[model samples]
Target chain A: DAGITQSPRHKVTETGTPVTLRCHQTENHRYMYWYRQDPGHGLRLIHYSYGVKDTDKGEVSDGYSVSRSKTEDFLLTLESATSSQTSVYFCAISESKRLVGEQFFGPGTRLTVL
Target chain B: AQTVTQSQPEMSVQEAETVTLSCTYDTSESNYYLFWYKQPPSRQMILVIRQEAYKQQNATENRFSVNFQKAAKSFSLKISDSQLGDTAMYFCAFGRGTGNQFYFGTGTSLTVIP
Candidate 1:
């Protein structure tokens, strides 16, 4: 929980539509991450932001994009929602990248694309 | 890129019994961190324990302890006196202290029975 909140906890969208999930944190953590959880896959990183305006791709970044305009907010965008993108998304924040990988996660956002 | 592997897909344990979940990772970096996270039915990620690669001793938290073998790249979680609340999906993750990304395993579903 750690002061992280994801907007629209649950959403159902049609294929080809665009979807944006927002993550806000009051911890002022410098590192933020977006991850997707599926039935068989534990959690796959979609994207992460090390600082404002600096983001990088993760293991499963094919159909995802991310942006961080402020220290407290990070956004994940799906240009065209696909059925394969339907899953529970998690937003996590960490105090530092040079520390013990201690990350605090939000409640999570459940998105279903049909 | 580091990859985490959770070999057990599902497991069951009786109340007050002990259980172990196995995890392995492929990473060339010498300085990294390992973590075990639990996700209950509520869909919240709870950090159970963590271990640093440089530390030879295993990390423990109450009834939750880890058996970390750095040479074999294995990090396993052993839960003693398992309770009903321990039923959840557990994930193993690996991250370089300096990297912003974390690699998670497919997960192991644990069921604790009365």
Candidate 2:
């Protein structure tokens, strides 16, 4: 397993409340990503960071935002939580820019928005 | 944009038997990569196997192998001598050589019966 950890392994928040999930890595990988997993949607990228302070939006980034101030950490925040955002969130890291490089994943965080 | 599709939502197989999971993808890029990931009840995502689009030979790992047909845009996983630990949700993913994001399929839940 990779030395990756996601804080607040399980969280329950009410609608319209602000929430943030943290992903920390010890591998010092150059790339980090955030993804949401749902019943019918296996996994949809929320955001990704190529380097410190360099980030890009993904397919389902409408309700989510992210920040990467340091190499070891990537954060995902929801300004106002929504029930539709209740799902399992995963963090992944890759050592190289090549697509063939294996991406290591964190255990995941289960968030429930009421 | 690239899309990965897993037609089988659920599959069952007896322990020690062989089972195959189907996956198909659509992409305009010629150079890319494909992967299969396993998520157990513990909610941890594990990389099963990987195949490079430019390679003509398929990739194999231990008891797991991938039948990658580049022209057909198909990448299927074959598990031999399956065990109970193999029971999990399997996902097919696509990644472009020059891109950072990955596109994943809905997933196929596999149950290894005793």
Candidate 3:
């Protein structure tokens, strides 16, 4: 199995609390992405990194931030947790760009905010 | 901006039967890629199949296949001999061939009744 792992498989936090989700990859892929999955919205990109220290915001990046200090690790942080931010977050890594390559995804982290 | 649409909110299929999930996308670029990802109750976003815009022939993997209509901007997923394990939320997505960003649809929930 291509190893992509997300930490804190499940988390519970209170409003205004800070939280961080970690994604680690055993496969050395150039592209890594963070996405949030919701009931009606399905999944939306939150952030993505092309290389170490290179990151960009996705469609739904507000209230969320990401960092990639090393190729194997990408971190997603919530400055102040909110109930609306409660969702399952996934980490995906791809050797090629989104259009033509296969993306391997982590199991996901379900975060619940109160 | 590109947009992916999954018109069907939910679909049901009998065990060992066949089912098709519909998806449509709008993009200006001629070269791109379409994808179907399955998210089970566990919430992991798993790659089901992918189709390149340049390829004329459809793509199939095991019991999963894609009907890609490049000109019509439609990409649909066909699951043959559907199993209970195949019951999950399927998402339609689009991405530029060489770009890292992707556009995703809401999703279609497929239920396999055994």
Candidate 4:
């Protein structure tokens, strides 16, 4: 509810195609994260950005990539999407690095890869 | 890697009654943080409560409180007065003080029936 928005609330695409998800924040937070949620798997981190041009891979980053050219925008791209990548993706932002655990999330984007 | 565990897959409580959700975590570091997040059907992740490792006193927010046992590495959430709106998927998270990553549990689906 902290001015975070995830585009493409729902998308269905064929496997082996490229896909991109966008996360925009109006608060200009210093930290941004992308997570994927699946049944019985809760949520797993895909990638995160500490600042502009500063990114890091998370536990489940093998099929995902991220970019942050500005403080308010973070992008997650899936190159040659696979059926395993179908899940609900969420975007979160935090104001302080010291309080990274406390994040504000946007409405998730549900993606289905066939 | 830090791990969070929520053994209970589903819980139900009557409206206006009290309920508790169990959460246990494993971490190698002495100092770390614990958190409870709520994911409604809308798929937005909301922070329910937080507990600091260094603090002995439990943290409370309105009808929500946490019983944090640092020695046992247990952090449970107590909802004093449950409501229908409280029905959601609750996730336990672990955040190491030195790392920016947050490890999440599989989640517990809570149902508050009136």
- TM-score of every prediction relative to native: 0.98, 0.98, 0.95, 0.96
**What overall lDDT, based on C-alpha atoms, would model 1 receive against the true structure?**
0.93
Q: Tell me the whole-model lDDT of each prediction, alpha carbons only.
A: 0.93, 0.94, 0.91, 0.90
Q: Kindly list the per-residue Cα lDDT of model 3 for residues A27-108, writing each as its tens digit.
A: 9998999999888887899999999999999989999999999999999999999999999898989887544687778998
Q: Which residue ranges in model 4 land beyond 4 Å of their true spot?
A: A99-101
Can you list the residue pairs that collide in candidate 3?
A: none
Query: What does candidate 3 score on TM?
Result: 0.95
**Range of the 10 consecutive residues with the lowest summed lDDT in candidate 3 chain B:** B95-104
Residue A91, model 3: lDDT of 90
C-alpha displacement of B5 in model 2, angstroms? Answer: 0.3
Best prediction by lDDT: 2
Q: What is the DockQ of candidate 1?
A: 0.75
Q: Candidate 3: which docking quality band?
A: medium
Native contact fraction, candidates in order: 0.68, 0.72, 0.74, 0.57
lDDT for position A75 in model 4: 97
The digit string of per-residue lDDT tens for model 4 on B1-114 reads 788899999999999999999999988887778899998887778899998898899999999999999989899999988989999999999976754678899999999999
Give one digit per residue, the lDDT tens place, for model 1 in A1-114: 489999989999999999999999999999999999998888988999999999999878998999999999999999999999999999999976577568899999999999
Per-residue lDDT of model 1, residues B22-75, tens digit only: 999998899999999999999999999989899999999999999999999999
* Winner by DockQ between candidate 2 and candidate 1: 2
Tell me how each candidate scores on DockQ against the true complex. 0.75, 0.76, 0.67, 0.65
